[model samples]
Target chain A: MSNAGLDSAYDVAAVRQDFPILDKPLPGGMPLVYLDNGATVQKPRSVIEKLVECYENYNANVHRGIHSLGDQVTTELEAAREKVRALLGADEVEEILFTSGTTMSINLVANAWGRKFLRAGDELLLNEMEHHANLVPWQQIAHERGAKLRFIPLTADGRLDLTALDDVLTDRTKLVAVTAMSNVLGTINPIGEIAARAHARGALVLVDAAQSVPHGLVNVNDPRVDFFAFSGHKVYGPTGIGVLYGRRKILEAMDPFLCGGNMIRRVRKESSDFAELPSKFEAGTIPIAQAIGLGAAIDYVQGLGFEAIAAHEHQLTARAFDQLQQIPGLQIVGPGLAHRGSIVSFTVEGVHPHDMAELLDRKGVAVRAGHHCTMPLHEWLGVTATTRASFALYNTHAEIDALCEAIQYARQVFRRK
Target chain B: MSDDLYDDYILDHYESPYHRGHLEQPTIAHEDDNPLCGDRVHLELLVDEHDRIKEAWFDGHGCAISQASASILMKDIEGKTLDELRDFQAKQMLDLLKVRLTAARQKCGLLSFKVLKTMVYTLDERKGAMSPTQGGRG
Candidate 1:
């Protein structure tokens, strides 16, 4: 059933219609083939409309106002929380905490939880495949709390070397920080297997699902994820809104991140108590409309179904892999298509990644070129940068052809000189 | 004014860069990177007793624009005085490219020039540090 790929019933043309910006032309009347989905997906019309509707109708401060507008805004905001809870399959809605983005979400856990729980000799196990967002926060917390940072290492193909895990996951290991999928490598990690092993050794697991959640289903309870962080903008939603799903019991034990008005239960001149579950972590005025828009984005994705989206995206990825390979001097980084998601990052023999991106842009194909915020991963790959062509439901096979053509043109331009 | 940023001029410099390596006994050397894009440049200059740049070489790993900028700028500074090279502005290095750059791409084009400016001024900075003023080379 997990292999329910290439769903003939999945009509991608209809899906493209939902995202209006997909049809827009570039400056020279060339169609815009946006392949930067790994960074951020294009929002559906429903999400766009929901943002306007929030400001147009129920625009008020949540959880503090006495007016009807406040009631409506508060209700919508909580409703969005419920949707996020459902999306990640958390046991309770309050287990979900609203954050600015994945960076902040991970920082919340590192500071609030790590500072309290981690001992001096404790180790936080990480791997080379993790984004800077995942690695840097742990580095900071580990240094602050006098804990050690250990690496699990990666296989030659860029998958986590689980065989090396037994040696690394020791009794002193406090946490295993990993990404659900590599934003640069496109490798989908085995979170369930990693989590089970971590638990056996008394280490908690935190999954950075910024790349995974948008492309596939992630049930927090199934693998029994202790902490999961993801950005809303990456999942066809608005920017400035993200989710941090920690187990309710774990959340209750941790200190509140970003303290002030909303997160407090009672305030005195000297000391004060923090509020309960969700509110305790949420400080300051939240990104009100973005949360609501994220709810709509969740609804829009759920309406299409993960099975269908996966099937469609799988077809695109497989096709892109086959096509991108035939090009003479181009080598796609990461594992084979079976081990990866819809992202395809590659490097040409002579053409640099930045130069490749510029030439692709000339042909109206928008691709990301850089280390994709995984500098360590690039270091491991022995390259400075790679051009990434990441896909979504709206991307077509024809767009893949356009990508190949532009790449060929780029090769010619660099090869001749 | 060219339609393409990586034209023959830029690509030629990138593909077959002139004076692209380290010197055996360089008088001055410096290196830096564009943290945003991971582009990097390392420059080595041999200065003669006349206080002129007798020869210059650059080694870098980056896009066509940045690396070509290194090659082009190094070629221009081969026989120039140390003060003349020091007086060289970012606009002159940019004009050497003969291509229009966006704000972001401007950083790529001028990265080598930045290294050159830093290299030429390191002596003055070191001297200033020795003098010990309220403000040294910030």
Candidate 2:
């Protein structure tokens, strides 16, 4: 799956057919149109079936029993860990840890890594366009540890304000955490470059790939990111499962986030020793069934090919950007921010985002509205909220046309009044 | 209107909320904003001689649930007194929407009631300051 050859290999219709939820109808006798891929993607049949198969056949608590079911379950679970390792190009499967989602993963790093490393007067660098999950955790950590937190400003078009990077990334900066692709603006930051800068400054980089992993091909190996986190639900898998990819050495050095049964290797009267690399991070019962579903989802994504999906989404995004711009007063926000992802956010003059979304919904066009958990970004744009229509690989050109028609209809309805 | 998570009534009100924007001389004003969703509402209450609401108006912007809940709230409490408005609960409105809301959305759905509760308390305090005999238009 070379990047250059993916355009021809990808088939949009075939990809869409695998997701059964796409063919359904809504309460208003209109076809269900889902354009909220940045929030979460609907699971495909293969992923769903695999999840049910695990529960129906090999239904047992893993890692504790000598029965055949336990062994089978444990083996498959470990195999899934290997799949994720290969997907991210990690050096070892031991670097990947399962958590509830990206939020929890970041929390783990902040609590374990930040709590240990951060000293008084140290600095944490965050970007203005981060989802609240990424922003709040670090803010809390910085506040608790007496470490000052600063933000990498957004460019006028909503990309990272790189001109001021030299001023922000100072000697005091201990961490630089940013989103790979913004959930709101769809602006893809130059994360590899950012990581290089952070490393040069003797700081660690944490990439929030919750939006990027689903739409684009990400390799943790390339830029040498210290840690990266993403949610399974956003990547066409079930909820309650997420991946936190950390450098093996860094993860080993950090303390365990939670001390529970599985996380401990041995316990003495007054002291206890922790388990190995990945197990130390995962405490208590993991989302066993959800992880299996995630493995199936990764297989489904690989079958379609990550490069193909990226190209397909890029094509769809180009079409959507052009088509949406044709609608009167629809202003595309954050245009061309370092190879933007599939999420496209916009505002319509004289028409509230809430109103725009409703009008689109009446015509069977689904789009997300509001600040999209990026209030600082919206506030910077001088708006309370905006309407967003994000695309997935399953989305087709016809659906983009349908969305355009719906927007045109909405404009007419608003204009006539 | 389709089977998507969005509700038509919610969508309808979001598109064309009854009394959107600012209200001058807002009798009992209460404002709230959901920082997560960027939803905001400013509710106004105008009570009559009988201590019942003579007119109820709302102005602000938000997602479908917040806007629709405001519109529905205006309709639900138009003729009720502050005491009666306190009896208003979100469960009845949830039943009316007839759509299952996720945990996050359940909070969005009940925002109007939350607004009303806060607004009614403020109104009650204002009324308590005024004499019972001072009920007519000034």
- Return the top candidate by DockQ: 1
Candidate 1 lDDT, tens digit per residue, A209-317?
A: 9999988757899889899999999999999999999999999999887998799999999999999989999999989999999999999989989887888888889
Off by over 4 Å in 1: A1-7, B1-3, B125-138
Which of the CAPRI classes, incorrect, acceptable, medium or high, describes model 1? high
**lDDT minimum window of 10 residues, candidate 1 chain B:** B126-135
Evaluate residue A91 in candidate 1 and report its C-alpha lDDT on the 0 to 100 scale. Answer: 89
> Fraction of native Cα contacts kept in each candidate?
0.78, 0.35
Give the Cα error of residue A209 in candidate 2, in Å: 0.7
Misplaced by over 4 Å in model 2 are A1-8, A27-29, B1-29, B34-36, B43-59, B62-120, B126-138
The TM-score measured for candidate 2 stands at 0.84
* Chain B alone vs. reference chain B, TM-score for every model: 0.88, 0.79
Residue pairs with clashing backbones, model 2 = A26-B2, A26-B3, A27-B2, A27-B3, A28-B1
